[model samples]
Target: MLSTGGVVVVLAASVVVVGSVDRGATDSGLTGAPSTTATTQTEVRRVDLAQPFAGTAAAGWQDGAAGVVVPVPTPLAGFSAEQVAGALTQVRDVLITARLDPEVLYGHDLDRLAARFSERDRADVHTNKGYRTAIAPGSTLLGVPAKVAGTMTAKAGRPGELLVDTSYAFAYAFRPPDPERVNDPLHIISVVRVRTQYGFYDDRWDATGLTALDWSSYSYSVDCAAAEAGFLAPSLGKGGKPDLDAGDAERDAFDPAAPMATESTC
Candidate 1:
């Protein structure tokens, strides 16, 4: 139970979950044996995004992710964590049109090509994983190869509502930008994957036919002083809601079930 985003529930079987809690004891607290209370009761109090849940503070959160679409986005149902870091920074800036070579995603040797990724490509790891309190971390972008820093709980539902409990720092840097910075670039926080997802779904599949391929290279150090200061405030405030699993627990961003060969060897 590690909810509040940064999920870590290890069940690995009967999927389907929406998020209120069995992952931690915050906002929605209560586990086993208490489902039979009905004598004029009204205890459904799990809607506290640091209180005032009705709206306003999200300020449409810039709506920068371009109406966020993963499984659905026609009506704008969900997905916070700054719109999944702004649609993964437009999917790492459209991979700069695959111009390749950010030093091949800057060294940290997952053992030389690491059999080319697959257990969901490194079972979701994040180093230099910052974005809401990864505050400065040397202000990112220097030689990418960061690891062992945490914060990544990306749950998905509502045909994938897109959840994102960020804060990373497994950074790297090869810094070879000058090929016109790829003509019209924007590499805020960075990441470049090489190959996986069975090499883009058995070879060539797009339009959501799967193939996120997610290579094991990473980037993204966008910290214009933590975006003008609003790191979501110590994980939300006004008191009474702070234990989003409290710390360091892993997986299950919406029932991961299996994907842990000791944390993705590929």
Candidate 2:
């Protein structure tokens, strides 16, 4: 069984076989004969793997990069319309490369994402594992595109600064080593919600603080241990049962509007 937040995904139970025998004696003429019969029963359950997110909250979400929608850019107090548009576009690209890129997610590579930042900021991005998403060594994602939904908005900061805030949810569907053997979607899907703030500055700001990035996130249906190690391990991928007694704090993992979790649920 796999559980995410309050939702539980139960796989097929073990098969059970029952046998029964009957014995009776019959009298014929002067002799008596015994007759015996045996009966057997079995039970089985079926799970459909074709539609992994059919019944989940992510069912109606946008697919892959499409969900990271950037709002229409408008002129801010100190930034022009063009600058706002450019900043919004940059933030969108960063979010995609950091969270949804297959190479980054599976191979743990961050070169491309690091290139987006300045030389001074690149090192911090590389050292910070929280900037990217990764799956365990042997685990892999299902071919299905991830479900995403969120918004990006830009606002004026200080005299020469632009601030962009992004709120989004990414739902990844992972395939078990043996797809045919697993029966629950929670076993195959994990949801990650993120809240991020990015700052873009002009020459007026200090050279060392030209750009900045900060974010917080929470995940559902993911192995707590793996998450702490900076990797995502689906409940089925880890072959572990979910903590049913765990409180409702994790339920917000799927809600983009909810406040970012300040502490680990584990």
Question: What TM-score fits each model?
Answer: 0.18, 0.74
**What are the per-residue Cα lDDT tens digits for candidate 2 across 1-266?**
00012212221111001111111100001112211322142111122456677766777998999999888889988778887887888788888998899887875578888877655567766665556677778778888889998878888776787888888989888876666554445657888877667777766333332244455566776765566556777766343332342225334566788766544434
Q: Residue 183: error of model 1 in Å?
A: 40
lDDT of 1 by residue, 140-209 (tens): 2433222222223344533443433322222122222222221111121221112111112212212221
Candidate 2 lDDT at 241 equals: 33
lDDT of 2: 0.63
True-structure RMSD for candidate 2: 17.7
What are the candidates' C-alpha RMSDs? 22.1, 17.7
Model 2 regions lying over 4 Å from their true place: 1-48, 204-210, 237-251
Candidate 1 lDDT score at position 172: 22
Alpha-carbon shift of residue 129 in model 1 (angstroms) = 15
